[model samples]
Target: MEFNIPGIVNAAIPTRQDRNRNVMIISSNSGGSYNDSGFLSSDFPHSPAKLYITAESDSFDAQTLRDWRDEGFNVEYLPLGDGGSAYAARLESLAKSNNLGPCQSYGIIAYGDAASFCLEHFHVVDNNPEFKLGCLVAYYPARIPDPRGKFPSPVRAIVHLAAKGEDSIDVVGHSQMLGIQGSRRVSRRRLDRGVGAGRALDMAYPAYRYDAEPGFAEHDLDEYDRVSAELAWSRSLAVVRRALMGYMDADASVVDQNTDGKFVTRNLSQTMGTYTAHRSPHVTYMPTLTGAIDSQELQRFYSEYFLNKNPPSTELTLVSRTVGSDRVVDELHVSFKHTQEMPWILPGLPPTNKRVEVMVVSIVTLKAGKICHEHVYWDQASVLMQVGLLDPKMIPQKASERGVKKLPIVGREAARRVLQGFEDEEDGEADNELIPGWYDDEEEEEEKDEQEGKKENTGKKTKLQEEKGKQPEKASVGPETRDEDGQAETIPERAKSEPKEVEA
Candidate 1:
């Protein structure tokens, strides 16, 4: 929460009274060096509560600290040589210092050896009520604390364990150490019962196992797994926020406002205003590879290509939405008539005067309560098929040399199924119509039409040959003509004598 350097002059260091809480990160590098110049810059002028402590002779990734800063924390670095008794003394001095506000709380995140040290010596803060240590997060520690050991009130703890490589810990053994049967999967209930018997123990302490090697949560590491990292990040963030900030939720209004601006109001400025001012925002339409990066390009896209290009009959219905700490995901069903050239969705295509329907998914990430980036996804094949540009029946089959055949692409039925739901089988549209022999009736009708066409051509040829031998009689044209309904129709003799209308 607060710290006092014993040997250094008090006047040399400026005090940060504005920040009430602090987060101290103790890394594993034994010889890591630290610099405070970047942390004191004008970029982060808001909070001075976060600290990164490392050794004085080693080098580490600076991007890791910058990432924490991007998450709205003011980060600082401290260098301590070797890190043993001196480190413990420094932590003691910080706990005793009066610089922090009375109501403020601080948390710690430790890595590797430092994490092991924190887990072993956690009682330094857990035993003292005056120390304002709220939570502790350990990543891939060499040793774990006793599972049956209880952490007293006002001190919460969690540990992340790697599942593979040398860094992996024996989780089953640990569960057995707590007097439970050794199983491949650790039971939360049994662990809770084992640890929550005493009044001093905290029942909510969590230990998560990631199916990756150590350093999976760090962004700059070679073994970094985004899926694992994100999952762990959400969990760790939830613990820290619960301890310090009482669970602040991500706001969905920003995304809603941005959507309204783009679809309803069609205001370029209003849409752009929803993005974060702190960084350059980007948007990507994944299907057509049409999107904009930064303010100027985005404005140009909205004005010249997107906002005015949508047809008047365009309609968007929200199917579902999921909101997280810093992002929003929306599933939308969009329908429109192909009455105008839409550069965003149907680039370089003329209006086919056909109705189009498709399902779209948009993922919007936010920073500082504003949009940071957007990823829009939709099935382009279904869009093309709905507008009559793509013919599934004419598509070539790649598996065989059977020149050409049908593809599995669908038309408006895909969107219809999504909107109407798939539970009602009887009322739902037919399935697997494109599979061979699935629709035998249609195949029989095609064969019948082909036979009728060959017979008509033979009759015409025979009649021409007969006329050739005669007195050069005028050859009659086909007896059949296609009517408006696309059916064969024979012209009557009375109708042939009728006069045609002239345009003049």
Candidate 2:
């Protein structure tokens, strides 16, 4: 799909190319004034195909709508007071009045924050299966701000571009997943489960509290740049255009606020400011000691521990969920387990570098093919507490209170080294304890076979007797095996049963 955006006026832009194929551009309005600098009107998309569906003046980016009429594109700017959510309904009514053909493929290019409303209510107006979607552009579309009910709309191809960010915290470990990369693409399933968009990553901004002070200006891009250039989110307009049009996935949250455990149905009118402190990937980590960890670092940790070692005898198990979508509206939850190690995190100390078995669960949400929210869980704080932080009490005040376990960056190397040393010591004593059991089983089987041969030579075999003899083994009962010559094989008493395990 080709997109040509000159600037943004409010959240809507103009598309003025009227050669052959005409694009149905719809703009939702909220009565915001359009700026001459950031508005897209005069120069529409380079393609010679465009149309505009706009709403009233004074109550929206009305000034920009006037320019569309002069540009010679088919301009049908209506007054929302004249037609509310029923605007599309009215369009349909008009189409029914006039004999219109499906020859004109349709597309939606939303400016300012009007795009969110359009996405929120797509299923309501145009429900025809024939109208899959030409393209959808939501520039600066705000997140779903409510948690009451849902307004579901899914276009085959949709793009959402936002200027702000959100924060996260829960049962997961403590760490911020920052973002400010040019842009990213996420799927719809991930919108519900939660993850990250590849583009806007490691940004410095934090989530603004729903109820911050009145003077907090949401437009502080300059201040952010001055404070830390890395934190600035003002990417080139062209880059943002690509970011918003990358995909049509629905794995993203409609609401930008906390998407869990509360009013999850509320939609916001606009974002007040940036949201920081992303949810760490440890929100759902819980399982047996032999489970798997799937992070890149965790895999490397195991390579250093078992695979690269001389004999490669250190058994490693890792449990993890593949990284995926984190959209609010539609999301996907994926989980897996294997044996591995963390060279940087120790089970009992801060992991500077060590490999150990672990489990991970990640929930990601995606919108327009980009991650909107992500939650993760792991075992870090407990390890540090076990090895000892500067002060167990101060290790991670919030994490400790919630019983979260994670290793901090400061003392990670020492803790991992200590854990590796501990592992080496434990692996050394199992030689005689585990290997002999296999040999003993073989010897016992041979003795039993000899006894069976002798019994066969002495007496006639009975069907009932044969079944009775086999029943004991089948039922896993009457344990001790002895030779027909009358001798019980010595059982190795090293180790036996293990404790039960669980996960979150």
Candidate 3:
């Protein structure tokens, strides 16, 4: 009696051997692709029982199966149908029938369409399952299905998925949901150029070594770049190996502590004060007391070189400061005038009378207000470039000449211009308004107004004098009364007042 999966596999049942672990290799090709199977068998570092599966095995080679068996794989060819309907059921049945322990099956290595199918349906076999998949390695999957859908099954396994190339399907963007919500430990790899899916697989599993001359894994399709394939292979292998070995990358979280800003500043000032005063004794703690440092050696480093040696003139300008609960981070702009030789600070450089300006950050950890330790950081390249020792052109660093005349406008005005998009704007009418000789002065404007007022007043006075000169002779006398017909009646007017009504 032959033990075979009905409708899935044939009746050829080989005697099984006890194995420590198993690797299930899946492919979508109906005709068993012995090339991939052979490559994987030889490339895998560990000797685990390999199971080669396919969706359609109508043209399955019996000789190939014999070859794999000879190479030592407790192999079985379980054929799955379209839509992957029998995949999950057949996988579970095979595991149960083999009497394998929960951890006996190490991982699944799927390529092409099979890779996509396995990822989508891996959950079906995982949910309410009896076994654990240690890890999953998928190469150049055809299509990622329902990435947004919940896949709580594969969370237990570490997933190492690779995208084909830049132009092709973006594996990272498409599979983002799966990586974030589906798996606990997931990593992605990008193989530049259309290196093909086989190249990525070959890189990870170097089943066969290529000769000096470039050769394609698939000889029929001349689509191989040997250099790219080799680089991608190394990266893929590293990710897969690390995942299977239960190694995880380190992570750190930084929390901003609400510290007393004034106290932190005071402590930092003291540290700089010691440097300025050239007194190592005033330091809070011995330089080499802790942190892989020798106390006596550090004391010599400070007293003999840092303090006593030719300490260059420094003008420290503070840039920013952040105070945490027990730590203080200070960023400062340090200007060093290299007038004397300081072997400790500048190492072997001879005094060149050069002034170098560089930004340095100091992180100080404190306990009970006194400084416990301080770590200072600065870019040595900037300092080197400033001192003319390093050629900025060669290093590709931008050389900025110090003491360059300040812009016509700076500070608040610069900020205002930037906010107003002045850089992109053309010179409008408003630009000329503030230019010299554009508008009149207050004194000139007042003088023009005063001259116009005086001219109008003079014209009015001249008109009044002319009108008086043209007045009648009677108006000049003022006391004489004049009658209508040019007759004088002065005597009657003085005598008096009561007069009868005159005839009409």
Candidate 4:
């Protein structure tokens, strides 16, 4: 099984050569642009050889293709014709041709429909000695297929689905399907307010919307939700890195989110001594302590904001963590039963006692094995909405009159009930016919016109013109034009039409 896929391979930078891994990105569409920058910066801790494959080789946008190439990714633009067997064959062929091995850590990033297809046929590459995929990412698939099907794939994969809250696919069914599947690990997360698939991975895509103008479209108009997309991407990146390249524990002293719902500082002495004890600036929504909060200030913050003032139900579940050469990225699902009002987080609002769940990503930079800086990110808009501090009517947000529950869909029973409430609507128009007849009226008319055109043009070309068409037009030397900068420029035929000025 050989695929005639014309591809260009790219290697990592000299410094990251040893840590180089491989990632194959399968595009959903048939064609893409090729003119790409293909530059992977040094900030990316790992060197993963990225192979981007599109369906069509000849049909592609020059710029888009170049952009993929510029990012130092291997790109194969050959069509992966229709049929599931064909797709599986092409993937197997790609793996064999690339000579992917255990030494060359590998993973797959399947986008859109490609994700669904890959998830279904992923087992094809599983048993291959030359290609062992460590992690699999399905970026916004239409409907997460039943993972418990007869052809079980013993792989750990994450499925990200968009929450449009309209005539959308059955996310609950998808979640339950993944949850029930007997696999290594399968995590299903619903990104609320996400308008479409691939929106989480590609920030450039527009998000889903409900209303038009002054209604719910006011604050929710933007195509890309920076907070959701960034959070999702960070988590996805961490999962891939840990799955492919592996992870290590970052030595640091911090408040740990214990199973017993207690915030305990482990090894406080060593952690406090390792820090510079300088006052660190707080930029997030929490306004308790601001600007260079030292070790003492941090302890005070932990006591006042987290331990004492914080609600007893406060919980932070570790989602995914990636340990890099210079920094450690942690993704956490922070939640709390808002029983007490803490002015530190919500400046003026009182406790509504509502349960809240929000995702957070924290990047910790280390200087000589000591924590130098940390950048924590989470959607404040979402948190405000969840805690009932912010009014949804006043602002366009997910937590409105809608009955969408907070994430982590509890157990299988809850999942079944959640799935039962909704009717499985057709993904497409049920009334409209999707498949066309054997003969397309417009296409037949066009073909007739094309044949007539060819016949008409056959005799239009003169013998000399036909002969010249076979050969390249020789450049005729002529008077050139000068621009403001005195750069010689080619004079257009219209400009050349002007009568030559009398020599003066």
Model 1 local distance difference test score: 0.63
Candidate whose lDDT is highest: 1
Ranking 1 against 3 by TM-score, winner:
1
Local distance difference test, per candidate? 0.63, 0.31, 0.39, 0.44
- Looking at candidate 1, what is the lDDT of residue 300? 91
Model 4 / residue 212 / CA error / Å: 17
Question: Which parts of model 2 are misplaced by more than 4 Å?
Answer: 1-113, 116-323, 326-343, 346-356, 360-377, 381-504
lDDT of each residue in 51-143, candidate 2, tens digit only = 333333324343333333332234344343443447646433443343323322233444333444444334222232233232343334344
**Which candidate model has the greater lDDT, 3 or 4?**
4
Model 4 per-residue lDDT tens digits across residues 121-190:
5532233323344455555555454333322121335655544453344321222231222223234544
Indicate the worst ten consecutive residues by lDDT in candidate 3.
Answer: 250-259
lDDT (10s digit) by residue, model 3, range 372-397: 34566665654564566554334222
TM-score of each: 0.61, 0.24, 0.27, 0.32
Candidates 2 and 3, the one with greater TM-score: 3
> Which pairs of residues have clashing backbones in candidate 3?
30-56, 203-233
| TM-score between model 2 and native | 0.24
RMSD of model 2 against the true structure: 22.0
Clash counts for the predictions, in order: 4, 122, 2, 28
Ordered by lDDT, highest first, the candidates read 1, 4, 3, 2
